[model samples]
Target: MVETMRRRGSSKGRALDLIRSQGPISRVELAEITGLTQATISNLVRELLADGVVSETGRGESSGGKPRMRLEINPASRFGVGVDLGADSSTFVVADLAGTIIGRLGIDGPGALGPADYVRRMADDLAHLLDGLDIDRAAVVGLGIAAPGPIDREAGVIVGAPSLAAWSEFPLTAELSRLTGFSCVLDNDATAAALGEFWLGATEVGSTYASVYMGTGIGAGIVFDGTVYRGSRSNVGELGHVSVDARGPECPCGNRGCVELYAGPHAVIARAREAAASGGIDLEFTGVAAADFAAVAEAAITGHPLALALIEDSAEYLAEAIVSLVNIIDLDHLVLAGSAFEKVGAIYVRTIQHIVGERALSRHLQHVSVRMSVNGTDAAALGAATMVLQEQLSPRSLQSVTLA
Candidate 1:
């Protein structure tokens, strides 16, 4: 049994994933896919239906005798709240079980605000977000937070996030839960993005994949057999910390030549700024990380020599780290996410795909699908909400995007 998934409960949870992803499917199909007896599938589906989690959408094509009834998730049965606490700004969203965003709000990052103060403001923003929607407050399952980590997953805390200093050693979830009256869960930004992608139901059922998130730093979120795989302590996918150059600069993570040191947005923006200062590039410099990175990303996409070179170089370092991840997990797909990738995504995608195709040991098995997030940079916030839905929307299976 997959232990990470076990913590969320199983049997029913597993069935729900199958139905959410492959529905409108029949109970026969569920039995076939899950190796459960028809009786078991029936019992499970009955619970889901009674709970208003699953609905019988319509009849399916007859295999031999009567057409079978198809089952699907009921989107409006539940709701979740997500907060993507980012470096430059944060995103707040309310999503139904279907993963369709109901309401969204964006605001400045915590900046120097202490964790307690930030939580209070966040509670107000959340109230504002939910107030705008005609949603039942009781229907919101809980809250999910995606942030940069050194996370204490069990404690529901973001421990010493290097990028968001005031958040370090904070009981983020407890505070949010206390103020908002909803149980809260916190996870790495990349992991949350991957879950958000999984929650969207855009991938093949039971596929193994990973999302590579480019933000102030780099991280990966892995999904094995349609389940989010949070490694021990929920820090499974630290792609940025993987070494691409053993001889390169020292990283705060106590690693030499970490891939993030070269490929992450901070490094990219820093390079662009130095080049622009030296008259090597013609981009306007903004001290703000998001603005600066966006400027570089825009120039790179437009084919400016210095901008392209810097981004491409970062992609090369990123490619090295990605190949390592692919070899380890043998993922079926790779998703590129985060605000950092919003503009210069093509450069990274093309470069990473080239390197992975050439180097990944699993190349003989199948081509790994690579693509941009449908939600773009907003994926983390959406995924944060998915984490909540993952808990509250549980019946026996998977729900990404919309259920009905």
Candidate 2:
């Protein structure tokens, strides 16, 4: 009897994952893929449907028999809110169960703001956006926050964020939940970006992969065996702290030479500004925004010396970190993501791919594929939304991107 019960529980878990990923599928398909009986699939689907987690979505063509009924996630049955909070700004995105973004808003705010002020402002901003969209308040499932580290995942607090000082020890999830009346999940920004790519990016390689995020900071998310690998204390894949130069600039994290301090947005912008100033060329560095990184990259490609130099320097550090990670984890694939990458993404991809393919231990047999993220400039925010979807659909895995 105990064996049977265990089997049943396992089947239900499989059903949930399969349906979450490829729902709008029929009973036959679910049975075939899951190796469960048709009757079992039907029973599980019915249970999910009755609980309002799944819904009937029209019908599929039949093979000389009755048409099969399609079942999909009930997106309207539950909703979620995703927020990407950074030192430079915050972005909120609302998505349904189907991972479709319903509404979004972005704002500029200094990282010096207290957690309470930031959460309250985010709540207010999100409310305004939802109100404009005429969405029902009760439909929101939970809040997912993508924040900088280090994080206390269980306590839902920001342990220490040097990049954003006021956020230290902030009760982000609980406080934000109180302000917004929605449950919240908090995770590291890079971890959240990796989840976003895992759920959204397509690849023919092995499931184990790394998502290297280049933004105001450098962070990475490791997707291992189809699950995010959060180490003890729910913090892992912190590539920013990986030292590439022991005698480089002092980092806010107390490290003398971390990858982030050398390769993140700050590094690139600082380099660009220095070059411009040295050449007596007063140009607007505001063009370094995420929305314009691609254009900057194009200019660099055309032999723009300053742009190319800055991008090359950043890419070198980035590639160094990624190569180290690949050697350790042996990830079959790597994704370059975030606003920083959008500007010099090709340079990053080329550098990382070349280094990994040439020097990684895994290169002895199979080459590690390095590519840009599918999310583009909006990836962090979009992945922030996917965090909500992950929570609502696959509660087995923890969510990234919390409210504060």
Candidate 3:
């Protein structure tokens, strides 16, 4: 009996997902896409309309006699929350059923706080955000968290974050669920960004690509044929620690010349400071690395030779790393996103495109395209919210069921 109920839920969820993605579509079209019988589609659509999950948008053109009624998701039926916990800051966003961001909040450099304090603060912030929006608490389906890796996602523990050491082995998901009274899902920030792009960006379904997310560190998220390529243990795509120079400075990951050392924001700022000291250039800015990087980016954009050189050099190293990644993954499209790329993304995009065009293994057969994220710095947070939508509404197997 439980299995039968689960199957019914799965079928209903699949129908809802189809409508969300390909609506306003007719019952015949839904059947065609889902490979379900017309009767099953009718039954599902009826249940959805009765439950306020879907609605008849309008009539579609008829082939011969009767006009078909089209169906679409009712955007106000449910909501999802996404949180991006970065090294320097954390972002919270609330998205409605149609994947629209309705509310957003941020806390700068929250990693300095202990785990318990951070979680409490996050819960409080979430409450404030929902309350300010005047949204019904019962309407929220789930919350999705985008945090740094390596994370034990199945166990709902953050094994360790290079930026937030105090969060190691923390039961983040369970704690957030307990505090918010909503089921939560956790994923690496980069992977979440990829999912965000898939759901909200202009990419078509079933297209393969890579998204390189630059925050306090660098990581890549690989999407193949529309699904994130999470390796065994759900901790794949640690592109930063990939060794680029065998004889360079040793990284905390025990590798020499990891890409993060040369291409990350801190590395760029450190190099800029050194150049400023030697060349007698006054590098004035607040102590925050993100702000300082922004200063450098503005200088580079304004054609300051020293600033341009520093940014170009960092871009070169990043390009080299991306070339290797594209060659290995055989990806044709790449997205550069995160707080680090918020200002200087164009430089990185241009440099990476030039190198990949000349160096990628498949360059002879196809031109690789590199571009900035359409969702901008909020991609990870929005992706976190989409994660909840995907898990609760778009399960891959019809036999699998999860309590939301």
Alpha-carbon TM-score of each model against the true structure: 0.90, 0.88, 0.94
Q: Tell me the tens digit of each residue's lDDT in model 3 across 1-404.
A: 99988887778888887788788999998888888899999998999899787999889988897999999989888888999987677899998888889999998766468888889889999999999999998888899999889898888878867787788998999999999999999888898888888776457566669889988788888887676787777788888888889999998877899998988888988888887878745678676777888888888888888888888888899888988998888896899889888878888999999999998989999988899988789988998898887787666521111212
Worst 10 residues of 1 by lDDT: 395-404
Q: What TM-score would you give candidate 3 relative to the actual structure?
A: 0.94
Per-residue lDDT for 241 in model 3? 86
* Clashes per model (N, Cα, C within 3 A): 14, 9, 1
Cα misplacement distance, residue 271 of candidate 2 (Å):
2.7
True-structure RMSD, every candidate: 4.5, 4.1, 3.1
Candidate achieving higher TM-score, 2 or 3: 3
User: 1-404, model 2: which lDDT tens digit per residue?
Assistant: 99887666667657766776787788899999888899899998888888787888888988899999988777677677788887766778877766667787889765566667777888889889889978888777788888877898888988777667777787889998899888888887888878777665354424788888766677888887667787777678789889998999888788888987777766666666676779833346564344334444665878787677767877888788888998898788888777777656788888888877877876888888888888765566767677776655565443332223
Q: State in Å the error of residue 251, model 2.
A: 2.6
Alpha-carbon runs more than 4 Å astray in model 3: 1-10, 397-404
| Local distance difference test, each candidate | 0.84, 0.76, 0.84
Which candidate gets the maximum lDDT versus the true structure? 3
Residue runs of model 1 more than 4 Å from their true location after superposition: 1-9, 37-40, 61-66, 362-365, 395-404
Q: Write the per-residue lDDT of candidate 1 for residues 1-404, one digit (tens) a residue.
A: 58855643566777777677668889888989878789978887898899888899899987799999999988888898888997688899888888999889999977778778878999998887888897788888999999987798789887766788767777888888999999898888988898888778766766988999988888998887666777667777889899888899999888899988888888988888789789999887656788888998888778798888998999998999999999988888999999988888888889999999999998988898788887788888898897888776553443222112
